[model samples]
Target: MSRTEATGIRTVLSERLLQFAADRALQTREFERRVAALPADSPARASMGATLSAAKAWEAGLLWVAWRLQPRSRIGA
Candidate 1:
């Protein structure tokens, strides 16, 4: 996350963002590991890309949901 994102008082979904990032990273690492072990002519290359795309999409959806649930802070309360 950027400095503003981490330090903002506007982080209403910080926890969900953090978890989503962690999960995405892990999935990426696992995908890389498996892809590296696959043969050059393997038919699973397409599958690997599909799985990675799905993981990314899922993470994005979670972020969207969290954003909708985000709280707004009022000034001079």
Candidate 2:
């Protein structure tokens, strides 16, 4: 691939990854808020906890993908 094309691809992928990370952060915050408002004895709290953990794992996977896509050095330097 040409240097220009490779740089463009990396830029696009990085931007998309940033957006995905931000969205996941918002979702996690909202989930925590909902879980906290639940009573101590509420059965739903347990399920929400599991969901939060899964969301975190998903985010970590996305980060790994982003790391792999990033340019290791100046693309054309």
Candidate 3:
């Protein structure tokens, strides 16, 4: 994915996260904890996970999208 694509994904994920947070039932800490519980490599991270499936899906997609857009740069090469 190009940088622009990554930006778009990030925007989407951020917006979704914000929406989840905005919900009266979801506390900030609870929302964050659910996000943290998702596997680092899991697509759910970008979405809701453990907390709420729908939210996880959206968040996971974002993370997946970002992973795609990330540049291949060697570290300490």
Best by lDDT: 2
Q: How well is each residue in 1-77 modelled by candidate 1, as lDDT tens digits? A: 87566546346466667677678878787877888788978898878878878887777777776575555566995
Q: Can you give the TM-score per candidate against the true fold?
A: 0.56, 0.82, 0.33
Best by TM-score: 2
Residue-wise lDDT of candidate 2 within 43-62, one digit each (tens)? Answer: 88898899888988888888
Of candidates 3 and 1, the better by TM-score: 1
Model 1 TM-score relative to the real fold: 0.56
2-74 in candidate 3: lDDT tens per residue? 9768777766766665555455234544777766876799876765544465555565665565455444556
TM-score of 3: 0.33
lDDT of 1 at 24: 80
Candidate 2 vs candidate 3: the TM-score winner is: 2
What is the lDDT for 39 in model 1? 90
Q: Alpha carbon lDDT of residue 53, candidate 3? A: 58
What residue pairs clash in candidate 3, if any at all?
A: 43-60, 46-59, 46-60, 47-56, 47-59, 47-60, 48-55, 48-56, 49-56
Q: What is the lDDT of candidate 2?
A: 0.85
